[model samples]
Target: MKWSEICIHTTNEAIEPISNILHENGASGVVIEDPVDLTIDRENVFGEIYELNENDYPEEGVYIKAYLPFNSFLGETVEEIKQSINNLITFDIDLGPNQVTLSEVNEEDWATAWKKYYKPVKVSEKITITPTWEDYTQKSSNEIVIELDPGMAFGTGTHPTTVLTLQALEKYIKGNETVIDVGCGSGVLSIASALLGAKDIYAYDLDEVAVKSTELNIKVNKVQDAVKVKQNNLMSNVSIKADIVVSNILAEIIVRFIDDAWTNLVEGGYFITSGIIQTKKQMVIEKLENQGFEIIEINELEDWVSIIALKK
Candidate 1:
């Protein structure tokens, strides 16, 4: 069987949403090649080795690849994906370059091409994300491991945005606290909350694939009893107050829910948000401040920023 490899050249800010688009359009797996990874200092802690070749990455922006079976409707599907990506501009998402290309490959090639991009990596002080196929053992007593099969879904649990959120969760989530994860892709934040001793976690995502993916991941991490996965648009219908609310989504989407988040948090609750690029950092800060949130901490990794605010 033949497969169609759809490759998109876009900005880091658009990676999560575009990956979701490919998954919803029936792509089996997605591969991301960001030029920034070439310069990341991997000290190879815990004997983990990284094999990255700089030649494969684009000089600027990033390349996102997904595989779909070559079929009669492949062209139509590709066109729809392009239109949907172009539509992101309406939301003020910078899609940098936005050049898309396609190629044909054999099924065998498609099966193994994306595996090399994924490896076990420790994202935070206590949290380590490992691909389901990778063999890794905990190197320390306090290390928490999250096993995931990204499977065309966003949030591999290793992105800087996610890493910052998980790190904050580790620090802020006291035992038995009620937590909410907005735009919970793959349930990584929710799962990390549970692992950190949160008594109850509510995970919400506007995307159906994300909801299902979160459910699957929660079960994989054996935290199904602690985390509840649901499909909801931000906090539109959510009324339950939480001790901590974490959202790793676009800054624009985060701003839209500032009021909702403030209303849904108890006094002194923490609202953690990521997936924000550096340029929009001040915009998000002002919105949070206007909503009466006290800035607690602001974290930056590469061009990504994660803001932690307190509802006081």
Candidate 2:
């Protein structure tokens, strides 16, 4: 029982796609260490404090780490991951140094190493995401707690992109509205929607692993009846009219489905988009506007932007 820890030195803009490549290559779990966390100011509105170790982070670029089982094909797997990350450059993604290194660890160490990086995080005014292995007490009567495992999935529902989307969902969803979640990694948004009183939800992902992960998380949250999980490309052939269409993915992918999102949303319905780097934020905004969506709000966290628009 041994594991190979693959660490990639890359920029913050490359974290999402690189982590995705690792998961698709059968990595068990992914961990991100960004130097910005060492000095970034966090608002205490949610009473969440971070205790980060400077030694664990890179001085300039971010570190994207994933665990792969030690096996005969480990070398090939690592090569494929490297090539996939390099291909990201074609999409205009910055790769920084792109230096990759590996280390060996026992199964016991690998299992517990990533856990230290995750904790209960208050993402929005009413929503707090906590790992299943952690015990969290609600701070108020109105607080909502989401227990997530994020096993072999994308994130623990505490990433800035996810937090922004959850906050937008909390603000827009009144109650009992149908929600369509595109690129629903870890099912966090769909689960949050159900907790926010969404009546019916459709969660779709191009990756089968993501679809399965979403299904498992939905059941864990006891929202199985509210969310229907499926494996599909971004909004392809989706004809259901929804009150809210939410997606947290690359800005490029988000722009590709702007038309589909506009068509699937009912009049005055909302569209929430995240996972957008600051440079591409304006591009997504223009695409949404061209699709006849009225830009409602724009919010940013740690250089990640989320936009909320209404189909008017």
Candidate 3:
């Protein structure tokens, strides 16, 4: 099977509205590239941290890039996907040729192409995510290395949500605490919690891919003895209240599930809510406040923010 990708380059300013439009129009997968992005590779540390000039902004508006896989059911050729996307986007600029680029790849090509990017990703000053295929010999023995081979799942310590949660875990985690990683993608949060000294960690995800990915990650990281992974929605069958709850779900989901977040946290426990874009900040905050959580910090990066709160 061949996989095709569509690029809709838009501004950080206009991306969300266009994204909502595409999603409403039945687009499934979307990855964003901000105006600040000077280059391609998403994992590069240079362009991400480089100081920007004001001239980077589009004079008219932003770009919206959407990736549609190459499949017949997606209404045939890349041209068709582009037509549908254009209808939804209501934009004028053509992204050069290949309004939607279609690439043919066999299973082996897909496996290798994605697997190439899965090298060692250091989450914090201490923890490192090393795929089972990679070597961690450069680090000292005292360093905490999470061996993860995440395939078709969300978390891999690359996204800001996972990184912020790891930072929060390092600070808020105390000895012998029960941790619940709601929406645990690739088990990054759960493994980090266990490494940070949590007595028990329960990782749950609504997606089966996430559940399986996290389970594999736990086994690879040698935390299978301590961390448990299950395919379930957040707090569905949680019996013992947790000392720390970490959720990196979408802003609306966090708002909708704030009560469940509160229910999982013990008295004076910490809850970290990430995957929040800048626009939905107030809605999530108000919901958390109403649910008896006192906001501790709003950590921001690249127009994204993570809310860390404590149960009142």
Candidate 4:
């Protein structure tokens, strides 16, 4: 069998949404190669940091590679993906070079190619995300390891936004708190919340694929009893009052659901938001403040920002 490798030269800001487009178009696997990964000083406190090849990354911006089975409808699917990606600009997302190319590859090569980019990394003080294929043991009893199969999903929980969100979750969730994970891609946050001692968790995502992906991952982490997966728009018709509401999505979408989030949280409950670029940080902060949320902490990783706000 043969697979077509589609590579897109795009910006960091566009990674999440563009990856969603590819996933929607039936991409088998997605690999993101960012030059920053080669230069960033990762703290290998409890896990091994895999070596990255400099030549595999783009000189500017980033390359998103996806594999799709070569078939008769391949051309049409690619066009749909291109159009969907181009539509992102209306949301004020920067597409960068936005150059896309394709190549032919054998099935076996592309099947495992994306795995090399993944490894167990401690995203937060207590949480380490490793692919399901890796064997990771906790160096300390306090350390939490999340097993994820990210090939069928959008996020592997290693991105800066996710890391920041996970770190905030670790800090806020003491124990027995009810968590609402808005836009819970790959169900990583929900699983982390459960592992960190949240008694009950409700995970929601608009995309059916994401909903399924989160469900699968939650079971893999053996947190199914604590986490409930749902397919719903962000906080829409969600009346469950939560101790903490965490969302790792676009800033534009995050601001739209401020009221919903407010209503869904108990008084003094927390709202954790990420997937916000540095340029949009002020906008999100202002929105949260205007909604009567007290900004507790704003952390940045690789120019990506995450905010922990208290609903006072």
Candidate 5:
């Protein structure tokens, strides 16, 4: 069996919403990423595992998800996903000038072509990601393991945003603390908080994919006991308060979301936010400061940054 991948570029924060739009329109599952991890899960002899896979992309990284039905035409489902996403979804296919793109399937004969791309990724000094099929070796007796397969609603460890989030998490999360990860993509930050010794980690996102992906990832990482993954947009139904709130969102959303993101936190709680480019860092800082959250630390890696603050 084969599937035609539909590549669409949209706001990173909106991918989850778009995935919901696609699922409602008849797409079974979607792979959402900045560089577009077309394949997130790899089949194995034992069962299944999660890992990244290779897909070709030309200029302007995509937040792509492929949808297909065994008996459907490529344009049928593709257009549905496109329409649901509306102007938020833009195509690589340009109608003017002589550019037309055709749908293609994976040339690999093996059913589990995605397995080849599954490999270990370093998340932090004590944490590493391994696909479920592979054995766990070289893990320290006291170290943390976050088992994840590539099939998730959000980007994986390979992305710079995730890496920067992990780095900030390592520094900020601590023992027995109550934490919340707003816009918790794939539940990585919430899982890391649990691993770093947070007791109660409440995570939710606007996308149902985020809720589902986070549930899967929490189980895979064995942090289910510590991490509570739910589907919510900025703490709609969560009754408990948090000592730390971490949000990885676009700068504009960060500015808009901090009001609610902070409302759920305890007075002394820390709010760590990323997905801010250099151009928007100052605006985020000023916004957070205006909210009365003292700026404790700001980390910059490449063009990405994570801001740490305390509710005063």
Candidate 6:
């Protein structure tokens, strides 16, 4: 089978949103090549050695690549992706040089090429996200390991947005609390919640691939009993009141369901939201506040922001 590689050359600020656009359009296994990474001083802290080739990266900006099956609709898919990315500017997101290009590749080549971009890394104080194929051990007694095979899911559990949400979950989740994970891509948040001592977790995503991926990942992490994966549009039909509701999705989509999230949370319940670019931060904050949620904590990592709020 043949595959089409869609590569977008944009600034670091646009990486998260562009990656999301690709995933939403049915592209799988994204590869991010950031020139900044070539200049970072790793110092060997994570036990992984870096041997980067400067020529492989763009002279400026980063390149995000994803693979989609070569089909009759490939042209339409690519155009829609471009339009979605162009729409980001309205939210005040800075997309530098937004040049897009495509190429054809063999299925075999894509199967292994994207794996090199993933590795085990500690995203928070206790959580370390490791790909299913990597070998890693806990460096501390309190360390929690999350094993994931993201497959075609939107998140690999290591993105800053996801990391921020996990950190917030660790800080806010009390034992035996019920948690709802909206847009539970790869089921990482729900799995993390269960591991953090939540008695029950409801994981929801509109994408069928995400639903299946979450189910598989929950089983991989041995948290199937505690986490339930489902296909639902945000919190639309969810009727259970939860102690905490967490969502790592676009700030625009996050605002659309603020009322639903507030309605499904018990008094004093927490709402943790990430996947917010810095530009849309104010819009999301205003929506959460308008829904009667008091701002509790606002966390930022890179260009991403996570806002934690409490029901008033």
lDDT of 1 by residue, 14-74 (tens): 9999999999999867999998898888866432457888888999999999988899999
TM-score: which is higher, 5 or 6? 6
lDDT of 6 by residue, 257-289 (tens): 999999999998999999999999999999998
Which segments of model 4 are wrong by more than 4 Å? Answer: 1-104
Question: Which tens-of-lDDT digit does each residue in 1-312 have in candidate 5?
Answer: 665656565555565666777677677787655544444344331122344434454334455555464455666756655565664436432312211223556545434565555666666677676666668786577677767764634554545566777877787776899988888877878888898899988888888877888888888888899988777767666667888888887988888777776788888888888889999999999999988889988887768888888998
Candidate 3 per-residue lDDT, tens place, 1-312, comes to: 655455555445445555665575456756654554554445454112343344643444344545455566655544454565466445653332223343344566756555555667676777777777777664876577777777754545767766776777888886789988888887888888888789999888898888888887888777888898888877776776988888888887877767887877789998888888889899889988988899999897666788999887
By the lDDT metric, which is better: model 2 or model 3?
A: 2
- TM of each candidate vs. truth: 0.70, 0.70, 0.68, 0.71, 0.64, 0.71
lDDT for residue 287 in candidate 6, whole number 0-100: 92
Q: Supply every candidate's count of residue pairs whose N, Cα or C atoms clash at under 3 angstroms.
A: 0, 0, 10, 0, 5, 0
Clashing residue pairs in candidate 1 (N, C-alpha, C atoms within 3 angstroms): none
* Candidate 6 vs. true structure, TM-score: 0.71
Kindly list the per-residue Cα lDDT of model 4 for residues 224-279, writing each as its tens digit.
Answer: 99999999999889999899999999999999999999999999899999999999
Task: Looking at model 5, report the run of 10 residues with the lowest lDDT sum.
Answer: 93-102
Q: Candidate 6: which stretches are off by over 4 Å?
A: 2-50, 53-105
- What TM-score does candidate 2 reach? 0.70
Task: Write the residue-wise lDDT of candidate 2 on 78-151 in tens digits.
Answer: 99999999999999999999999999989777566677667788888899998888889999999989989888
lDDT of each: 0.90, 0.91, 0.71, 0.90, 0.71, 0.90
All candidates: CA RMSD (Å): 10.8, 10.1, 8.2, 10.3, 11.3, 10.2
- Supply the global lDDT for candidate 1: 0.90
- Per-residue lDDT of 212 in model 2: 90
